[model samples]
Target: MSTLYTETHIGSMQLKNRFIRSATWENMATEDGHMTEKLYAIYKELAQGEVGLIITGYANIVAEEKPNAGMMGMYDDSFIEEYKQLTELVHRNGAQIAMQLAYGGTKTTYNVGERVIFAPSEVCERGTKTLGKAMTIAEIDYIVQAFAKASLRAKQSGFDGVEIHGAHSYLINQFLSPYYNQRDDQYGGSLENRLRFLVEIYTETRKLVGDDYPILVKLTACDFFEGGLTFAETRVICKKLAAIGVDAIIISGNIHGKANDMIGESFEGHTIQPQGYFHQYGDVISREVNIPVITVGGLTDIDAIETIAANTNIQYFALSRPLLSEPDLVKRWQNGDRAQALCETCSKCRTKRGNFCIVNKQRKATIAGF
Candidate 1:
């Protein structure tokens, strides 16, 4: 009934309002994968601009399993103090922040010094041309510990919350969808069995962060591939998630190549090739689930943004391009001074891997033209 800007609660975390700077893979970090000055400044602006909560770009929990060399990682505690500075900046700007803990399932292109890629049950991520090693039960246990350990480190780093990157057909996504995973073990087979990895991640993560700290996940509204995690199934999954003690869920989807490949982009087909296009799926999940939800996919229109809020039934409005376009957007909007501009949809924002926004500058554009 109320608009998105109305303040809301996501688990124990109190948002100043309901506008979320969605977790985008801002390639703005060190090659070794750490947030640098530009990364800090870009987010700091959003914080000052009055964004409700910020779910930062994916930060890998381990190194060799990195899908790409550009992914930021929290692989070691040595980096925690460094991350502390970034979180402190966000807090000073008046926003709470959550670090997206990630691990590339079979999509990892970073082979620098490793040769093994493990999935809950290796069917090799749908349409991919290559194959990764199947995760042995013992290996699966280690991976779960990696997530839990990373979450504990996140808490120690002073982040407000930890969000498991289960959407986009990543590690957890593959296991959730029957299309990618093919095993007869307890970790596979039925829907309940398929979701074991996520349940494990959530259960252990809860132990790591405690009841006071918020824990969330970004899961697909649908895989958009045959027999993947469809909206219908997502509804069922959400119920199970509630029992597992998940705090919030970010509604997201994956773009597959011509077939349902989890990692690589298809030359042509419905894989989110076009930009700013993923709210319908989010709404589907929001309607079926009772917990707070955040949705994103090429979102960058005031009317479109308002439509997502006005007629929709979700708790938050999320954006990757818009924030990359202008960090101060919410601040300007709140002061009755925001404008509309196409995100260029260049997607150069996600392409550069570890460079600052090459497409848009911050605070320079007057929020007066939309």
Candidate 2:
């Protein structure tokens, strides 16, 4: 009987509605990873627009793990006050926010200056040709501790929770995928070994944050590639995470390299297709886990949202491009406009300048009679 606008709780964090703003890479922070006024304004706007929950852009857990310029950082203690200010602003505007802690692994570029890239095993990553060195046992232990410390910082900063980014073929996802994780050590080989990294991370984080503080995870339901993490494997992973008291699971998939399968591309004959491109995988995973499952990717239509809420036990709907196009999308739907989002999903927001949606800007200008 729950609806999109109904209030819900992900562990102890109570949200006003079921709509969540998925974690996106907003290239808006300083090179050293300080929060900026422009970044603060984006979350304030989303808060004022009435989105239920907002997960911030990926915040690197360590300096060497950063994926791009302007990616936010939690690697240092200095960044805590800035994030506290951000959380205060968003909370004052009546929205809940979570910081997504991540490590880029081999998916990063060296333009940020040369740093050794760490991976499950030393392997040549596709497209980049850069050979990632296998992470030593000490390095692996360090990364795990880093995740726990970052989660502690998120709590100290007054964020409602922290999301461990284990999706999109990042360092955590790389560990989960057999295609990338070929190590025979305790951190690889068997599925349990591969998942040990995440399990240790969650365990350590929970120990620091305690039982009441929410600790959610953004996980890939599938890598959608041959020899990659599959839906079946994902189910087992989800169950284990649930058993360890993961507050919720935000179901997502793949990395940017597999854009077609990861984000779903527009075809020649279709201007509009089904909403919630990853719902099928999410549905399967949702049934496997007892925790709330939030599904993201290609969820643009209001009708589709209502139908999914009515038919499935899925607890939350997360929108990325749609919120970029209309930050007040949930408000508009509640007001009964019920129109599908205008985002073409061209993903121009993924540009180097920042995560600004040019199509949304143009639409706004048009509405203003420009």
- What's the TM-score of each model vs. the native? 0.87, 0.93
Model 2 segments more than 4 A misplaced: 110-113, 255-273, 362-370
Q: Identify the runs in model 1 with alpha carbons over 4 angstroms from their true place.
A: 112-114, 126-128, 256-276, 353-370
Error of 1 at 136 (Å): 0.7
- The number of residue pairs in model 2 that clash at the backbone is 0
RMSD of each: 5.0, 3.9
What CA RMSD would candidate 2 show?
3.9
Q: Could you give candidate 1's per-residue lDDT for residues 99-192 as a string of tens digits?
A: 9998777755456226677776646565443466778888888889999999999999989999998887678888888888887999888888
List of clashing residue pairs for candidate 2: none
Query: Which lDDT tens digits does candidate 2 get at residues 28-50?
Result: 89988898877888898889879
Error of 2 at 274 (Å): 3.2
lDDT of each: 0.73, 0.83
